[model samples]
Target chain A: MNRTWALYKKEVRSYFVSPLFYVVAAVFLSLCGFFFYSDLNFFLQFGFGMDIIGNFFQLLFADMSRAMLITVPLLTMRLFAEERKLGTIELLFTYPLREREVYAGKFCAAATVFLVMLGATLLYPIHLYTVQPYAFTVVAAGYCGLLLLGLMFIGVGLFVSSLTDSQVVAGVGSVGLLFLLWSASWNEASGSDRVMGVVKAFSTFEHFSNFSKGLIDSTDVLYFVFVVVFFTNLTLRSLESRRWRGRR
Target chain B: MIEVRNLRKQFGSTVAVNDVSFRVQTGEIIGLLGPNGSGKTTIMRILTGFFPPTAGTAWVGGLSVEADSIAVRRLIGYLPESVVLYPDIPVARYLRFCGEVKDLTGNKLRERIEAVIEAVGLGEVRHREIGKLSKGYRQRVGLAQALIAEPALLILDEPTVGLDPSQVIEIRNLIRNLRGQSTILLSTHILHEVSLACDRVIIIHRGDIIAEDTAEGLNRRVQGVFQTLVRVDGPLPEVVGALRSLPGVDEVIEDAVPSDAATRLRIVSREGEPVRKAIARAIVDRGWSLIEVSPIQLTLEDLFVRLVRQQPSGH
Candidate 1:
C-alpha cells in the first residue's frame, strides 16, 4: 500500500508537471462554461417554468458526458504509452510493487484529475444559486453520476493506452472506442431492443442517466464500479502478458 | 548472488535466448558480451524479473524470478540499452520519484536521492529539466536511477551505447567505482569495456553462450596455437626444417622472401609452447644473427572474432 501511494504521488505530480494536464483542464473548463451560459440563455428565452438549476445541470451533465468521451482519452493516452516510449515502464516494473499496485496508483491519479475538472464546473451551480437557491442534493447527485461516468471512460482509455506504445494511436484509439460505447444504443429498431438492452447495459451513459435524473441506484453505481475494475484488470493482464511474451 | 539454469525465451517461432545459463557471485562484475540480436538484453530482462523465461528458471538473491518476481525485482536495478527519461521532469524530482518507486520515503528517500545524485555527479544539474541536459548528463541520470536503490544486483544493458568518447570513459569509471559494492552484469559489444570493467566475461552469439571465462582465460584459450615471427640472417630452408623438427613446433611456414640480411620466418607451434626461445637457440647454434624473435599475443578482439567465427560448430 505504501508503494501504491508512492506511485500515485509520482504519477499525479508528473501529470501536473506535464502540459497535458493543464491543456486538458483549460479546454474542459472553457467548454463547461460555454455550455452553462448557452443553457442559461435558452432557459431564459423559453421561460420554462421548470427549475433553471435542474435544467442547467441536466444540460451540463449531457454536454460534459460527451466531452468526457473526448477528454478522457487525452488524459489517459500517455499514462502507459509515454512510459513505454520513455523506457520508464521497465524502471517501474523493477520496483518491488505488484502490477496491481501500479495499476491502481495510476488509475486513481487519472481519476483524481478527472474529478478536479468536474469540480471546477461547480461554478455553474453557484451562479444558479445566486439567482435561486436550488436543491443542493440534486446538484450533488448529478455531479456524482458525472464523476462515475468519467471514471469508466478513463478506465477504457487507460486500457487502450496499454495496448500500444504510440501516444497518438492510444489517444485516437481510445476516442474511437469511447464513441462506440457512448452510442451503443443508436440503433432503435423493433428487433434491436434486445441488442440495445445488452448494449445499454454496457453503455456508460446509460448507467449515468439514472444519476443525472436525481436517482441513486445501487445497480447503476455497481455497473460503473465493475466496468472500472474490469478494464483495470485487463490492463494488468496486458502488462503481465508482456512478461510471458518476453517483450520487456 | 544470481543463478540461471537452462534459460530459454522464444518469440513465436524464433528463439531469442536458447538454453542460456550462468551464475554470478556477490561482489563480482560480470559482462555479457554479444553481438546485436544475440539475446543479451533478453537474458538481462529475465534475470531482472521484467520478464520471465519461456523455459528454465532464474534466481536473484535466493528468490525465484518467476515465483517471487517482486522480491527479485527489489534485489536488482536495471538500466536499459536506450535510457529514455521523462524529459519534462527536473533531474532531482525524477530521482526522488525513482527512490519512491524503490520503497524509500521520508528522510531515507531524501538521503538516497541526494547520495545517488552526488554519486553520479548530477549535483550541478540536479534542478535542471532532463530534456535540457546534455547527453552525458542524461546518461548520468539514468545511472543515478539504477544506483539510487542500491540493490544487490545491477543490470546495465549497453549503458554506454550512445555516449561520446569522454562520456563513455566517465560512465566506465563510475561503473568501475561500483565494482565491489554492487554485483554488476553489464552487456556490451565493445571488447575493451568488458576487459576494463568486468571480472568475468560471458560471450554470447546467436542466442547461445559461446565463451565464459576471465579476460585472461579467453586470451590464453585463443593463444593456444602460438605463432612466432623470427627475422634472421640465415638459410630459410634449413631454419624452417630445424624449427619444424622441434618438439612443440606444429608447422613452420616459410615466408616468400629468400634468406638474406633480413629474412622473416613464421613458425606455428602447439599449445603451451615457447617457440621464440627455441628459434633463438637454433639461430645462434647455426651461427646466424637473429634480428628479432617476437611471440604474437592474441588481443581480446582476436579472441572475440575467433569465438564468434567458431560459433557455427556449436561450441
Candidate 2:
C-alpha cells in the first residue's frame, strides 16, 4: 500500500469520527448561509432580474471568503499540534514512512475537509442561478481560486501546527500569520511605486481579487501555488527536524 | 539483527546515550536493563530510527540506521516508553491503522490485527476506546500495535511498566511466545522482567553499558564470594557452630525465627569450593537433622544494583 495514502485515510477517518470537524463545518456553513440569505435579500431588492456571477456574487463572495478562510486554519490546528501533544507524532515518525509522506498525507487530508466545507456552499450559487442566468466560467474560476486559497491556508496551518505542540498556540499563531498575509494590501502606501509593488506582491487579497473579476491569470495562480508549496515544504522540514532536534 | 557501535546522543549538554556498543543476534531476546533516564530508551530510539544519534552509528537487519532509516523502520516494530495512543480511537481501529502504515493490506491486515489482539489478550475490549481502557489494557493495546506487523525485530521500551502482577505476567508471556519469530530488544528497569523474559541482559547506567551477559553468567560474575542457606532441625547454636567449623566455610549466621522448629543458617563460602557436601556430612554425622541445603543464587535485583553501583562517580 502507498504509505501516504494509508496515512491520509487514517487522518481523514480520525477527522470524521470526531465531532470537532463536524462542529466546525456546521458553524462555518451556518455563518456562510446566514450571510448568503441576507445578501440575496439585499441583491433581490435592488436588482430584480439580473444575476451575473462576478457582479452578483462579488459582495457575498467577499463575505464568505473570510469565513472560508478562517475555517481552514481552525480545521488544521490539530493536524500536527495535537499529535505532538498526544506524543503520537513520535509514533507517526517512527513508522516505515518518509517525513514528506506524513506531511503530504496530512496536508491533503485537511485540504479535502476544507474542500467539503467549500462544496457545501454551492447551494448559495444555485439559489442565485435560479433567479437568472450567469457566467458559470466565473463561478468555476472563483472556486478554483477559493481552493487555492484554502490550500495556501492549510499549508500555513501545517507549518504553524508543526512549530508547536499546543493546539491553542497553533490556532492563534496561524491566524496571526494569515492576518499579516491578508492585511498586506490593506495599508497599501501612496508613498512610492517600489513600496506599492512590494505590498501587492505579498498581499493574498491582491491575487485573490482577480478570481472574482473572472480572471484566471497564470501569474495569480502561480502565486497561490508558490505560497502553498513554500509553506508545505517548510512543514516537511519541520517534520524532518528530528534529525537535528533529537526529540520530536 | 541489531548492532550499535559507539552510539552517542546529546539533548543539549546532557548526554542521553554515550559511546554505547552492542549487538543482538537473530532469534535472541536481549533485555536492555536500565533505570529511568539511563539511555535504555535512547538506544532503542536510535535502533528504531526515530532519531539519528549525535555521534555514532546503528544498523537494523544489516541496514545502516542513519543512512537507511526508513528501511530500518521497515524491519523494526517499536513500542515507546509512554504508550500514548489515540484516546478517541478504538483498539481494533488503532491496530488497523498501525497495520496499514506497516504496509499490511487486504485480508492480511485484518488477520494481523486479529492475531495481535489475541496475542496481547485484547479481545475482550477490542471495541472499547483506548482512553476508556484501564492502564493494563492500554499497555496491551500498545503491545498489540507493536506486534501488528510481526516485523523482524521488535523493540519495546518498558513493555510492562505499570501493569498489575497478572497483566505483567501476561505481557511477559506474550513476548516470550515471540521468541523465535522476532529478534526482540526490550528495555525495562524491572529486574524480574529481564530475568524471566530476556535470554541475555545488558545492564546500562549513566548512558553506558555497565554489564552485558546471560542471566546465569551475571550471577556467576557476582559469585566470587558465594553464599548458601542451610536449614537444620536441630539446636540453633550447635547447627551454627557445626557449619562454622567446616573447612572452606567463611562464616555462618543464624537466619531462623525463634518460633520455627528448624534453625536456618547462612553459610558464606569462597567461590569454587564445594562446601555443601562437607557441611551435609558433618551435620548428618553429628546426629543433627539436615532438613534442607541449597546455594543462594544471586538475584537479578542484587546483580543489577552491584553493577550499577560498582562504577566510580563522575565517569
Best by lDDT: 2
The chain B TM-scores of all candidates, as shown, are: 0.79, 0.84
Candidate 2 similarity to native, TM-score: 0.92
Name the lDDT value of residue A198 in candidate 2. 88
- For each candidate in turn, give its C-alpha RMSD to the true structure in angstroms: 4.8, 2.8
DockQ of every predicted complex:
0.64, 0.73
Residue A15's lDDT within candidate 1 is 88
> In candidate 2, what are the lDDT values of residues B84-185, reduced to their tens digit?
899988999889889888899999999999998988889999999999999989988888888888889999999988788998888888889999999999
Q: How good is the docking of model 1, as DockQ?
A: 0.64
**After superposition, which runs of candidate 1 have C-alpha atoms over 4 Å from their true positions?**
B225-297, B312-315
Give one digit per residue, the lDDT tens place, for model 1 in A71-135.
88899999999888877788788778788998889899998888889888888788778977868
Clashing pairs in 1: none
